[model samples]
Target: MERKHFLKSLLVGAMSAPALLAACGKDDETVAPSTDSTSSGSCTVAPTETEGPFPTKVPASYVRSNIVDGKTGHPMTVKITIKNANNSCAVLSGALVDIWHCDAEGNYSEYGGTGMQATNYQSVHFLRGRQITDANGLVTFTSIFPGWYSGRATHIHVHIYSASGTSLKVTQIAFPEGTGSAVAAVNGYAKGMNGYTYNASDNVFSDGVTQELATVTGSTSAGFELAITLNVAV
Candidate 1:
């Protein structure tokens, strides 16, 4: 879904820090922090300062597609909406967000390779890129459904950018669907069946994230809409 930063490029956009922070995507969308759960604000800003890789570059031809071989999305395309964390959160308009993920068969090209290494693609940036949020601090991309590996559920990696193209926060977002956790009940992974959704037991989305980042939704014809929330600890 995205890539890593080279030297952390941050080209501060023209929006004022506070005004820019006000327009981050968090406002209208779900998954806001507890204090702002019902509060609707753009939720766009990211961290402002960093030490290492900051605003990275978007990889070549990082547009949406099936896979490296041009595989089309199964039921529909994977639409990712990257918005500024929250206005005043620090005007991350020009911040770079890098993404990368696996194919429909749990295989990552540049990083993990295949087979035994299937679960560790973090070392590489396959479907990676650097997308700058608009005035609203939002960037959307169309991509294919990611497949699951042996030990991990389907997921996408995201790295947020701060002011001046500094790498502020680096985290990953994943989808969970399967029986037992409504994934199976909704997607019908129960009764000895497999589906795009995993369970509440998915490993990738497992650290203190109880329905935090991704909100799973299913469509009979559109496959799934794995809505995500990227909240930097800043």
Candidate 2:
């Protein structure tokens, strides 16, 4: 946001998360055009997400899991607003974001097959897709709470796209502790699931504090709001 578009890795395990992003190279932030119409200033107009060290192990085949990624799909109702740190108009309408995550039991659908135990088959492309922000730089979609799987912790992957159609696969987001419902269904239903802690130990969220990192919102009256800041390169 400082120069052209704001983007940077922002980390090292030895240092703090915010400090890391500060250390990483960041692009200048861009604003939305007045003629457009999505909502207000929110994510950039670039498509795709800023990819990162986040794993890219897509399976040969996968089933739709409990959650679907991106800004479209089954009506899950998610309002994604791309704005600057001040919550002003970051206005990047038409930007594409590539999002992906796990199901409640933490199993991935696409990367498995007959070779591995069916993690339940999917009816469609759940947890994978691209979201294009509206003219106002806001994009909303439907999706469910993603499940947790092995090795990796609970989190979401996102990549950014620039106006030039360049992809900045660098930024990512995560859910903070005391977030989401502490469900018994996942641990009980899945063989390997149980006692999934919401600590910062997980690889995806070890850094614990960055715009890419997620923090939980909402309350007993509503579901959780996994809020995060995505510095887009547009």
Candidate 3:
């Protein structure tokens, strides 16, 4: 498959924090919760997944809560909590959490004009940011509900690291069902629900989504909220 081939090719150069500091840098539900891991008390270790083709090369520079970067779509607020699987699920405060995703039109910033993505957003950075986990082991980002791509479901890529910059995990958050309708509701997304791939068919999610699935709440009209707990061995 083209998507699988592309993913394999990009694996070597996936984003990392030590590269540079000058690089750039969600939705609720009309949907059901995919798994129980969203609960604050769940300690199941989150499944590590690929960071995908696009990642923020210089994550350290974009350390803000709002990663919208002027992109327009239904509003979304993403909350992620980090927990240590090796320590009785204790909150892993001070971990670095970095996230990036496609915009409402399924195009990623800082990348485009390639065989996989052709939108040409290489000049600007939007929908990408990094935040350090707070005392509560949580990092929140203000963003827009992501749109679908040809072979992947609606999702977000996350990279976690220790406080001292040691790499911990590279994973992703999968959206719940009913995400198609939410994508259709986006104003300028002409693709609508035409070529969307659901979690069941997604290469990264097909095996299972029990640990990576997120709990989404809210609606297209009022925007949405996503909350997920990620447990990693520290």
Candidate 4:
């Protein structure tokens, strides 16, 4: 369904989802440190990742902070801080950050592909958006918890651009196994826990998800907060 129709169909459901979250008292928890231990100096830059099969250029109108205006699924806040890997990881302000992910049903918005089961959503643009980094080199988006699809673990695509709108780096982020499993159990997730894939088994993260896995806090009932720092040669 296109975004307009998609939102219309779910308007009532969207209005009530927040109340469910509040009733459950799901609050933010601090993200665990990466499993792979490394000092700041020893850590290499965040791995360069594939844009996957559904990459799209977010239109200016879609370049807003909240990407989940009328979308379903548990709420999540994703914050990315851009940094210069060569400059003692100094924050890089003014970078353009674009992010996209699938809805709770494992269907993406704005791009159509064989990987995505919903062909009707080819032209639909829902969970797709971008934002500019602030003085703290941070860009945040309000999105819903993403659903799982075959052949891949739960993940989100990210693209970084210079303040001039020039591309700087492209990569992706994944949720911890515990969080993925927890979120899958929520009301709207169709895939359920059985549909989840751990970082070791996922085709993209199997090589290693040490840096790609985001630190997630919060719960299924209330929502989740995800934070990941992107190290680039900005």
Best by lDDT: 3
RMSD of each: 12.3, 9.2, 8.6, 12.2
Q: List the residue pairs that clash in candidate 4.
A: 29-218
Q: Show where candidate 2 strays beyond 4 Å.
A: 1-76, 83-89, 114-124, 179-199, 219-224
Which portions of model 3 miss their true places by more than 4 Å?
Answer: 1-42, 179-188
The most accurate candidate by TM-score is 3
Query: Global lDDT for candidate 2?
Result: 0.44
lDDT digits (tens) for residues 102-199 of candidate 2: 55555444444432224544433556555666676665544555555443445566654544556544455555544243232223234434545443
Q: Per-residue lDDT of 1-234 in model 4, one digit per residue for the tens?
A: 001111232334544422211111011112223221324334345666656456665455678988885878888999998876656666888888889988888777765554235455776688888888888889999889988665567788888888887776767787776534444446337656664566677655777776677888888777888998877665
**Candidate 2 accuracy as TM-score:** 0.55
Candidate 1, lDDT over the whole model: 0.43
Sorted on TM-score, highest at the top, how do the candidates line up?
3, 4, 2, 1
What is candidate 3's lDDT per residue for 1-234, written digit by digit as tens?
001222444444653321211111111111122223435534556665656468787989899999999998889999999988767667889999999998878888988886667689998889999999999899999999997667777889899999999987777888877535443355236666765677777767777777788888777789989998887778
Please list the C-alpha lDDT of all candidates, in the order they appear: 0.43, 0.44, 0.74, 0.67
